[model samples]
Target: MKNLVVAAAVATALSMASMGAHAASPNELAQIREQLEALMQRVDKLEKENTELKTENENLKAADEKLQANDDYLKSEARGLRKEAAQQAVEVGKVKGADWAGKVAITGDMRYRYEMISDETLSSSGVQTADRYRDRIRARLNATVKATDDITVGIGFATAEGNDPRSSNQSLTSVFSRKSLDLDLAYFDWKFATWGNLIGGKMKQPFLKPGQSLFWDNDINPEGLAVNFQGGMFFGTAYNYWLTETSGPETNLTADTMLHGLQIGTRLPIGQNSLMLAAHYYDLSAGQGRAPFYNGSNGNTTDTVVLNGTSTAVLRYDYEVVNLSAEFNTMFGQTPFQVWADVAQNQDADDLDTAWSAGVLLGKASNYRTWELGAFYQVIEKDALFAQLIDSDFANGVSDSEGWVVRAGYAPVRNWLINATYFLNKRNIDAPTSAGQLDIDYDRLQVDFNVKF
Candidate 1:
């Protein structure tokens, strides 16, 4: 463009020179030439300024594109960072919830009872015992923690009158005296396999007691190591319990007493119904000729032994007991029904070594507004079982008794129930009394209000 402008100017100048060569003087021509030079110089300066402006414009476009690219990148990174932070917050909340709330559990029950007992026991002096009535309360609290996926730890506390392993009832006597509270359960359970558990410490009974059977009292928590297993329809338990720890030598079987037990059972399906049968065998080593009595003998046959110049009644025979139990479960028109039987024998005792019980139950007292009814007849001979470990409420916790127990329960609300139990029993059925042969009538009634959480 600059060259074209200069050429056009030169052509115009030549045309003027050619047109005015005869009519123009030297000064005019010289002035025209000088003016043409000045215009060319001005055109060159303007062209240089236009080139600089184009270069500046290209640089500005490049800088704008670079800034826009940077803005887009920053926006995308910020969005990703915000999403990652939200996910981290959610993960933190889940961990907090599991640690504080999901892994720990607290559970317990409280029961208040009104009990009445009528005894017709006759003493050697021909005196009859009096009837008694009492109000009792039991409160228990337990806490469990899932320390790991396969490990659990539990601890519990309960109210009791004394250190009686069979009962945890605190009588409402002593004019509002401060009652005793003891450690009821403290144990750790480790799931060593998919089908078994290993538990140690003073723990709940690992053996199954079918159909509310009194062969093993519900409140008895044995101390030692227990192994429990279940595979398909088969289940079993083995336990090594410390009964007494004497400082005497191990070879002296008359001092230290230990109880070892094993139970094996199976559940078989039979046409929409199920039947469970189990056999449990336990032996009290070194119990014979030894006084391993807690709260006295409870009517087990005993022989007097002199210890430290004091005569004490020791167990007459070793207790090697085998228990067989069976239960048939069916549904009776939407109500659960069960028929069960339990029998036990002491192989070491030659006389009065058998006990048996049979029962039928209809319905279950579970959930709100549910009810149940059950009855069982049992006869425990003089040496049938270890009396200290049997049911404390049956015939006043004595052997040599035959009785019928009728139980009814109703749940008025969730986790709360009222129960009524009646015992019609005769004691001293086979054992000889202080007098002659005798069968004394004994009766008991208990009404309980229980709640759990």
Candidate 2:
């Protein structure tokens, strides 16, 4: 019985121990599960924080890129501005350094001419010579200084050198002296709005009209003041001079001393033609003693007049010259045709002292060639004073004078010109010894080559 009771107690103790082990195992498992749940929540919160940090980094990167782009744009604009400024500075420098401004100009002309003459007269002694050829060169230089808008000073120098056919043995010298420097235009031209201009200084005489004529050549320039005005329809002038004298002669006679003249005229345009009318007056008085007779008179007592007199010789010379000129020119059409007529009356002289000319010109001027055919009829009445002064040459001593001219030219390029011309002159002079007049004629042919710059 004791053995059986011990066995039962052992069995009970073993069962209790097993029960306790089972309960502890279950509690440990629950605690483990709870710790695992907390760990999972912590990991989820960390993942959320990581995602927020990644978004913030992306935004910062985008902002940095934008700022870089803005910086690049600003730099580009700055570079362009700097380049433009530099270019402007260079242009300004060029303008400032340019010395050939508004105050400088240069002009000159050179002409080489060959002339052949028939019926040439000897000037030393009254005789007629054979036909001859001559060569001549003429040059002119002009310069100006513009001190102001209204004031200008200028100088002109001209020279001519030639071989005289009459004196071929003599050395070639200056036909006109080399030291001939003239005050071309030393004047102050006042600008006016209503009136044209008022010029004062050594200026051109107002009596003669400007034309390209070699016949009536007058190498005379005077010092005077002039007023020029031109409006819509009216154009006229009143010019008075204190003196009129020849350039080479020094004299105090009425012809060389205080002389006064006036010119009044206007232009009327009819279609493409123009008509000019002018009237002139000159009063001459011998201010000093009578002019000396250096040459002996040829037994002509009636021709001699004593100039030494106290009497106020009211020698009134009046002239009325009319110009009827017309031009028909075109750029591409049938060239040009021009006609002119000049008539003058020296009323103070005899009835035969009248001078008149009528001319007609037809030309075709183009880039390659220019040709003209012209004919003129000139009549100069007999004048005794003119005959005496020119030493009985046909040019001065004339009952009637007539001439005809023809010209042809070619210009292959700018600055160069080639031309040829022919002239025929005829004169009839009244011979005092004979009951009739003497007839004389002359012919000239000229070729010219000219360069201008």
Candidate 3:
């Protein structure tokens, strides 16, 4: 570079010297030398500035590459944070779902009934017995909660005596004393699959009884575990009910009364009609004489049969029951009708071990002003079923009873119903008392006003 600049300056000075060789003096030559020197100085200054600019550009490129790498890293971190946030949201939703109280549903019903009862003994026996009249009320409240998609829990409160499982009606007696309100039901139903459910605690009866309430009452909620299954039109249930839980007198005595039950039923459609049929077998374990059937309730007590008139000798008793129920539902024009029957037998009782009931119902009530009429003839023999577990209003909650129940119901509005029922019944069917061939005609009249949510 220095050699090239020196050559250019020498060539320019020679040209100028040749042109002014005969006319120019020493001062002109000196001026040319000074011009050449100034040009060389300017070129050297530009070289230093260009080198500095190139160095600055290289530094800026390195900084730009570092910035690009940082940008990629920041973008990856942002994506990870967004994914983590979504996961946390799902976890929060699951946590909120387990808060059962906020998600529970509440429902209840109230029933007011006026009842009149008369027994033939009250009429005869040279005794003037005024008809018994009573007013009763039943109030029930229930709440259900969802624990998950497949699990649910329910709680219920009802008005009833703590000991009697068959009655929820609080009689209007005791000079306006506070009626007993008890825990009616508390259960968890776990549905692990589409076809089955496992339920625990005190719950609604898991067995299927048809339109006729023969063996089991409507108010009996069994405690312990129950399992149910369904496939197509077929359904079945198995239950292990805890009848008694007690600390017995001895260590080896398992005096607890248990009821093991199995039931199977089917519902099928045939042309324009539907048929429902079910059978149940309940094996009463340890219920022989260990358990009290609603203490002081004679209709459900077991008599101690002394062997050879010896009071010390007693017979072992077991009430094993098997029952079948069937119903036929068909439409007469737009009106619905049903014919149903139920039969039960106790394999252990000495006599009158079989009982049966048949009923006919016309015009099912579903809407406002819709009316229905039904009549049933039921004969519940002694020891056929635990009388305490039978319908409380039928035969006055006594076995060895045969009765005809006629009922009429009307709906004034949705979820509100008015009904009248007449029970023309007979008691002492098997003559448990000393009165042989003696039967008392006991009749009951009931009028109910009910509302439900």
- lDDT, candidate 3, 106-206, per-residue tens: 99999999999997654324553467999999999998988788988999999996657888998899899998889999999999889999999999987
Q: What are the RMSDs of all candidates, in order?
A: 7.0, 15.2, 7.7
Q: Which clashing pairs does model 2 show?
A: none
Selected candidate, larger lDDT, 2 vs 3: 3
Higher-TM-score candidate of 1 and 2: 1
- On lDDT, the candidate that comes out on top is 1
- Full ranking by lDDT: 1, 3, 2
Kindly report which residue stretches of model 3 are placed more than 4 angstroms away from their true locations once superposed.
Answer: 1-103, 121-130, 249-253, 304-316, 432-437
| lDDT scores in order | 0.92, 0.51, 0.83
lDDT of each residue in 1-453, candidate 1, tens digit only = 888988999899889989988888889889988988999999999999999999999999999999999999999999999999999999999999978788889999999999999999877887888899999999999999999999999999999876899999999999899999999999999999999999999999998888978887888999999999999999999999988877744454446788999999999999989999999999998888877777888989999878657998989999999999999999998999999999999999999999999999999998889999999999999999999898989898899999999999999998999999999999899876786646789999999999999
Global local distance difference test of model 3 = 0.83
TM-score of 2: 0.57
- Which one wins by TM-score: 2 or 3? 3
Q: Looking at model 2, report the run of 10 residues with the lowest lDDT sum.
A: 163-172
Model 1 alpha-carbon miss at residue 41, Å: 29
Q: Which of candidates 1 and 3 reaches a greater TM-score? A: 1
- Which candidate tops TM-score? 1
